[model samples]
Target: MKLFVFDLDFTIWNAGGTWCDSTHPPFAWKEGKLKDQENRWIYLYPEVKEILSELKAEGHMIAIASRTNAPTIAKQLLHMFEIDHFFDAREIYPGSKLTHFDRIMKELKVAKNDIVFFDDEYRNVEDIRSIGIESVLVTNGLTKDLVKPYLTRTIARDLPQSEAC
Candidate 1:
């Protein structure tokens, strides 16, 4: 089985129009939205939940690879967003993307090619790709269509009846 990895900042949530490390502190769940002290709203991309749910339903392992300076804050945000439980593995420290994947590889015991990584940064995509992983660049935000093709193409053969993209 393939492990699906996503970057946190842009790939998972907008994080109040900035990185999670840059967001104001004392975040809370206010009226179905997550807002910080400055009232900047942090939210998941439209298709994030749907995409994650579909991947989980298809019996795929999901992971997070974030380069945020504040790993605690990032994990807090994930928990507050109620999506922390989705990630089977999390590497959320600011460091080489290579290291993140390396830890994940060791932890999950999956080969580099067994991972499908998504990130908004071109450098990250290239970095992960250099290690022979199947990486995709998430431009604006993650969408079902953007991820569907890659997800479907990779795992449909192993699935009983993989959903059409």
Candidate 2:
């Protein structure tokens, strides 16, 4: 079994507030610095929930690695979408997701090589890769056709089935 991590912001939903865009949620702005906001999910992608279910059944532990101030937002979004059951943990409002990834890996006693991550941002993907985790970049909108190439065992891992794939 392997752990599958994901970044929330641009990877999942394009929430109205984005640190990358220099737009902060009304509650996040304070003294020229951005604070964290609460209670919101930008959007839920079609089949995202289903894909998660398939992964779960395939014995993968799903996790969310997001940079947000309010961790509650992550919980709320998961609960709202009925996707909470799939995640082993919801990391919200973290200063650095790479740090969280390290903690999670250590706590779970899994090697970084066993982790698969999905991120929309190139920087975040690169950061996770630095720690030995493999990450797939989520496109503007995720589709089976787009994701098919990487579903093969070759790019994702060196499983025995790579030849068949």
lDDT of 2 by residue, 26-91 (tens): 433345432435533255566676667666766777788887665665555556456778878666
lDDT of 1 by residue, 1-165 (tens): 579999999888998789989888789888988899999999999988888888888788899999999999898888887888888899989998999999988998988777899999999999988889999999989998777765754456556664543
TM-score result, candidate 2: 0.70
lDDT of 2 at 91: 69
Please list the C-alpha lDDT of all candidates, in the order they appear: 0.87, 0.65
TM-scores, one per candidate: 0.90, 0.70
Model 2 lDDT at residue 161: 67
Worst 10 residues of 2 by lDDT: 19-28
